[model samples]
Target: MADEIKNTENQELDWDSPISKDAGEFEIPPIGEYTFTVANLEKTMSKSGNKMADLTISLDVNGQAYVRHDYLVLTSNMAWKLASFFECIGLKEKGQELTHMPWDKVPGARGRCKIIHEDYNGRPTVRIDRYLPLTGSAPAQATAATAPANDMPFEV
Candidate 1:
């Protein structure tokens, strides 16, 4: 048997009460890098009918908390994006090919990534530009080490 759900259509809302103007406002974050934590993960289908994982991530910018959604569409051409998601959540190391993704471990995982603002449907919106290595993670350290020597004779 399924649990009964209460119907609230007839319930009246307190419209006369004062509400904060910024309570439900969504602000487009500035284009830059930010550390984010996975708040939720839900399996869904994209508009194109492809299997997709919807991720709700929480991030702080300038001491303000914000939530953003990222979609990981399952497809052959989208494998790279999926891999990046795994790497960002610490499920797999960067450059490590994975055949399976452990979705259960994603929630509460923290990672870093770049965010960019772009025009979508004739409106300005922000989105995840690319996943990045955590600041103190091994991949970040390796990248720093592999950087070209600043004293090189020519620009790299």
Candidate 2:
């Protein structure tokens, strides 16, 4: 099994990739060049054709699978959620003008941020300080800041 967030040691997760961003006080993760890869769409196979309970995805960076969750998403909803994030922040989509591309190995979200993962008191949080890219102008110099309304580190 892969190491959990709390158990993993901090290392040079993004050392080789060259990063680029505007030369102003841009937001933290909203700016910066990072390398990322999305997991290919997969079907949970079982002899019993019962509906799946959740979707499992393996998010990676240069073949390094950093995060994995079972049964959280598996249909168009998850794909749309991730795609909308890419569209919202003005990141490059895999297939331009082709609309509604499949969600396999697409250029997944990239940007290092002090991520706060939840809204309630029991929400999880994390800070990704790597080649995380930010959208918008350079004035958004990234730093420790509170998550915006209706989002707790949903910037992915």
Top model by lDDT, which number? 1
lDDT of 2 at 89: 32
> Which candidate number would show the highest TM-score if scored against the true structure?
1
TM-score of 1: 0.70
Per the 3 Å backbone cut-off, how many clashing residue pairs does candidate 1 have? Answer: 0
lDDT of 2 at 26: 14
lDDT of 2: 0.35
Tens-digit per-residue lDDT, 1-156, candidate 2: 221221134455477866563543211222223333333334464345433322222333334444433332335555644444344334534354435443342324233222223223443322232223345532121234677587855555
Q: What is the C-alpha RMSD of each candidate to the true structure, in Å?
A: 16.3, 17.9
Per-residue C-alpha lDDT of model 1 across residues 1-156, encoded as one tens digit per residue: 011111222545596966554633345668998887777889999999999999887766766656788899999999888888778767787777776889877877888889988777676677888888544553221121355557776777
The Cα error of candidate 2 at residue 122, in Å, is 6.2
How many angstroms is residue 55 displaced in model 2 relative to the true structure, after the best TM-score fit? 8.2
lDDT of each: 0.72, 0.35
Model 1, stretches more than 4 Å misplaced? 1-16, 19-25, 138-156
